[model samples]
Target: MPYDLKHVFASLPQMERGQSKVISGDPKGNNFLYTNGKCVIIRNIENPQIADVYTEHVHPVQVAKYAPSGFYIASGDSTGKVRIWDTTQKEHILKFEYQPLSGKVMDISWTEDSKRLAVVGDGREKFASVFLWDTGSSVGELTGHSKHINSVDIRQKRPYRIATASDDTTAGFFEGPPFKFKFTIREHNQFINCVRFSPDGTHFATAGADGQIFLYDGTKGELVRALGGEKAHSGGIYSISWSPDSSQLISASGDRTVKLWDVGSGSAVTTFSMGSGVNDQQLGCLWQNDHLLSVSLSGNINYLDKNQPTKPLRVIKGHTKSIHCLTVHKGDGRSYIYSGSSDGNITRWDSDLGLTECFSGKGHTNQVSSMCVNESEELVTCSMDDTVRFTATGGQEYSGDVVKMDSQPKSVSASGALTLAVCIGQIVLLKDKRKVFSSDSLDFEPEVGALQPGGAVAAVGDAEGKIHLYSVHGSSLAPEGPLLEARGKLTALGFSPDGAFLAALDDQKVLTVFTVADNYSVKGHFYGHHAKPVTLCWSPDSEHIATGGMDMNVIVWDVNDEDKRIKMPDCHRLHHVSGLAWIDAHTLVTTSHDSTVKQWTLTY
Candidate 1:
C-alpha cells in the first residue's frame, strides 16, 4: 500500500423515531460500538473522534455488543443474522455466524460466561432465540411473547437468568443452562421498550412507553418496586443503563431529557435536559465506569456532566447522511476539511485536532453539488437548490447572502475574487459576492466547471465529452479556443494550484492532463479506474492529480510520467467515492457515499 490510513471520522448512528438504538460499551470501558447502515462503528470512549468501521455485514446492522471477555464482538443485522468477530485485530476476523431468527434482530445479550447468547427481535415464528455462541444450536426456548420483542438481557453473574421486553407490554423471565420461559409479568399499560439486569445480578429493571420503571428480583423475577412513584418521565422511556454498583440507574426518554434515579429511595436524583426541538429526543444511553452517554434523535452523542446538568461536557457531531462533496482549506497554520452531505448539512473538521462542528443558520436546502475555497478564506458552494452561497470559514456560519442562479447548479469554482458556476443549461459569473454575468444561450450542455488559480480562464466541460475554454474578461467570460475533445462525456474537471496544468476525467475511465502554456496540448493520458471517474483534485505542487470513481478506487497520476500512478482499491467498501481533496502534497482527504471522511498519507 502506497498510502496509510491516518484517521477516520466515522458517521453517527442511524436514528429512527419511536425506535430504540443500542449503544454497547466494552467491558474495559475504553470503547463503545453502534450500527449505522450496513456497517458497525467502534470509537474510543474518551476520544470519540478516534474510530473504526466494520463493513462485512451484507444487511443493515441493528446492534453490536462486545463480549465480557473483551476480545470479540457480536453484531446483529436486519436479517436476524449474528456475526461474532475477533476485536483484537484491525481486520476484525469473523469467528462465527448464525441465523438465530427469521426477521430483524433488535437486541442481543451474553451470559456471564460469554458462552450462551440470547437474541430477541421481530420474528415471524419466534420473537426470541437462545443458543450457544460457538455453534448454531439451540440452548433454550424463548417464548411467551405474542408480539415483537424490543430488548433482551442476561444476568452477568451466577444463577443465570434471561429477561426480555416486548410490545405486548409484558416482561418475560427465564432461568437455566437451557433457558426456558418462566413467567410473564404484566406491569405496564403500553409497549415495553427496554429490559436490563444490573451488573451484580441482584435486580433487573424494565421501562415502557407508559413512562414506568419496575424493579424486580433478578433471581425470582418478583416485582419489588417502581421508581419515581407511578411515573418516571413525562414522555416514553426509550432506554436505561444501570450503574456498575447496581445502586442507581439513568433513563433516556422521548421528552428530550435523561433522568438519574436513586433505586434505594425510588426517586429522581437529577434530570439532564437535552433540548426542546423534535430532534432533541433522547433515544439511547450507556453507563460505562464513570461516563454517562446518551444519543439524541439528531444523531449527536452527548457526554453527561453530573455537576452541571444544564450543559453537557461535550457533544460529538458529524454527518448522518451520505457525503457528496468536500474541500480543503489551510488557515492560521492549520488544515481544515469541509464536507457537504446529501441532506444539505455541512461539517467542518480540524485535521490536527480531530474536532468537528456544523455550520449554523439556514443554508442550502438540497444536495451540495460543489465546493471550493477562495483567496478570502470563504467557502464558495453551489447547491441543487438553484443558489450559490459564500460562507466565512473562520466564523463557521452561513452569511445569508445568496446568489440565485437561473437553473440548478452542477458545479462551482473559485479563483481570487472570481467565482464561476455551471448550471443545468446556463453559466454564471460572480464578482465581489454579486452576480455580474449570465449566459443561458449555449450550444453544449455543461456538466462541470473549473477556474484557473490565477483567475485567467474558466474551463467548463460539457455532456458531450468536450472541454470549452473561456478567458476571463473583467467579470464576464469570452470564448478562448476550440473545443477540446475527450473519449466520453466529461464528469470532472480541475486546474492545478500553480495554474500550469489542467486535468479532466471522463465517463470512459480515462484521465487526461493538459499543459497550460503549450496551447492546451495534452501532457499525458492515464488510465486506471475500472469505472467512470466522478471527482478529481490536484496536488499543491501541481505535479500530481488524484481521481475517484464509481469503482470504489482512488488513483493518483503523476503528470510528468503517465505510467507512474498509485491506485487505492476499495477505498470505501459498498459505496462510491463522491469527492476528493488534498490538505498538502502528502496528505489526501476523501469522502464517499458512506458518510465518512478519511485522511490518508501518501508515501512517494
Candidate 2:
C-alpha cells in the first residue's frame, strides 16, 4: 500500500425518531462508542476529532459496549450476532463471535468481572439471553417479559443482579450466578425504554414512553420511589445515566430537553433545553466522569454545561448521511476540506488539525452536486436545488449570494472571476457572483464540466462520451476546435492546476489525460479501477492525478509515466467512493457513501 490512512473523521451515529441511540463509555472514561450502519465508531471523550472505526460487522450494528476490564468490546447487530474484539490492538482482532438471538440485539450488558454477558432485543422464541463471555454457555434464564426487550444492565457490585426494560410495559429482575427471573414490576402503562443500575449497585432506574421514571432497590427488587413524582419529563424519557458518585442522574427526553435529577429529593436539579424543532428531540445520553453528553435526534452530540442550561458548552456536528461531494481549499497558510452530504449538509474540516465545523445559516437545500474554490477564496457550489451558492471560507458561513440555474446542476467549476455550471440541459456562466450567460439550447447533454485555470476555456463532458471544448469569451462560451472523444459516458472532468493538462474519467473504468500545450493531444491513458470512476482531482503541482471509483479504490496516476501509479483498494469498505480531492501533492482526501471523510498520505 503506497498510501497510508492518516486520519478519519467518522460519521455521527444514525438516528431514528422515537428510538433511543445507545452510547456506551469505556471504563477509563476516556472514550465512548456508538453504532453507525455496520460500523462501530469510538471517539475520544475530550477531543472527539480523534476517532477510530471498527468495520467487521456484516449487519447494521445496534449496540456496542466496552467490557468492564477495558480489554475488549462486544458489539451487537441487527442479525443478533455479537462480536467481542480486543480493544488493545489497532486491528481489533475478534476474540469471539456468537449469535444470542434470532433478531435485532437492542442492548448488551456485561457483569462486573466481564466474564458473563446478557443480550436482549426483538427475538422470535426468546427475547433475552444470558451466557458466559468465553464459552457460549447459558449462565442464566433471562425470561419474564412477553414482548421485545429495549434495555439491560447488570449490578456492578456484589450479589450481581440483572434488570431489563421491555416493550411489554414492565421491568424484570433476576438474581444469582445462574440467574433466574425473580419477578416483574408493572408500574407503567407504556413501553419501557431504558433501564440502568447505579454505580454503587444499591438501586436501579427504569424510564418509559409514558414519561415515567421508577426507582427500585437493586438487592430486593423493591420499588424505591419515582424520580419526578408521576412523570419525570413532559415527553417520553428515552435514556438515563447516573453520575459517577451515584447521587444524581440525567435523563434525555423526546421533549427536546435533558434533565438532571437529585435522587434523594426526587426532583429536577437542572434542565438543559436542546431546541424546539422536531430534530432537536433528545434521544440518548451518557455521564462520563465530569462530562455530560447527550445525542439529539439530528445525530449531533451536545456537551451539557450545568451553569448554562440554555446553551451547551459545545456541539459536535458531522454528516449523518452519505457524503456526495468534496472540495479542498487552501487559505491563510492552512488547508481545509469541505464535504457535502446527501442531506444537504456542508462541513469544513481542518486538514492539519483534524477539527471540524459546519457552515452556518441557510445554505443548499438539496444535495450539493459539485464544489470549487475561486480566486476570491470563496466556495462556489452547485446543488440539485437549482442554484449556485457562494459561501465565504474564512467566516465559515453562507454568504447568501446565489445564482439560479435553468435546471438542476450536474457540475460546477470556478477560476478567477469566472464560474461555469453545467446543468441537465443548460450551460450557465457566472462572473462576480452573478449569472452572465446561459445556453439552454445545446446539441449535447452535459454530464460534467470544468474551467481552465486561466479561465480561457470550458470543457463539458456529455453522455455521448465526448468532451466539448468551448472557448470562454467574456461571459459566453463559443464552441472551439473538434470534440475530444472518450471511450464511454463521462463521469468526471477536471483541469490541472497549472493549466498544462486535462483529465477525464468515464464509466468504462478508464482515465484519459490530454496535454493542453500540444493542441489538446492525448498525453496518456491509464487503467486500474475495477468499476466506473466517479470523481477525479489533479495534484497541486500538476504532476499526478487521483481518481476514486465505485469499486472503493483510489488510484494515483503519474502523468509523465503512464505505467507508474499507486492503487489503494478497499479505501472505504462496503461503500463506493463518492468524491476525491488533493490536500497537497503527497496527500489525498476521499469521501464515501459510508458518511466518513478520510485523509491518506501518499508515499510516492
Q: Tell me each candidate's TM-score.
A: 0.98, 0.97
Predicted structure with the largest lDDT when compared to the true one: 2
Candidate 1 per-residue lDDT over residues 1-604, each given as its tens digit: 7899999999998899999889989999999999999889999999998999999999999999999998889999999999999999999999999998899999999887888889999888788998989987899898999999999999998889999999999999998878888999999999999999999999999999999999999999999999998899999999999999999999999999999989989899999999899989999999999999999998999999999998999998998889999999988889999999988889999997779999877999999989999999899998989999999989967998699988999999998898999999988889988998888889999999999988899999998999999999997899997678877899999999899888999999999888889988988889988998899999999888999989999998888998998899888997989999999999999989888999999988
Question: What tens digits encode model 2's per-residue C-alpha lDDT throughout 130-177?
Answer: 999899999889998889999999999989999999999999999988
lDDT (Cα, 0-100) at 146 in candidate 2: 88
What C-alpha lDDT, on a 0 to 100 scale, does residue 238 get in candidate 1?
Answer: 95
- After superposing candidate 2, which stretches have Cα over 4 Å from the reference? none
User: lDDT of each model, Cα atoms only?
Assistant: 0.92, 0.93
RMSD of each: 1.1, 1.5
TM-score of 1: 0.98
Clash pairs, candidate 1, are none
Model 2 worst lDDT window (10 residues): 352-361
- Candidate 2 lDDT at 198 equals 97
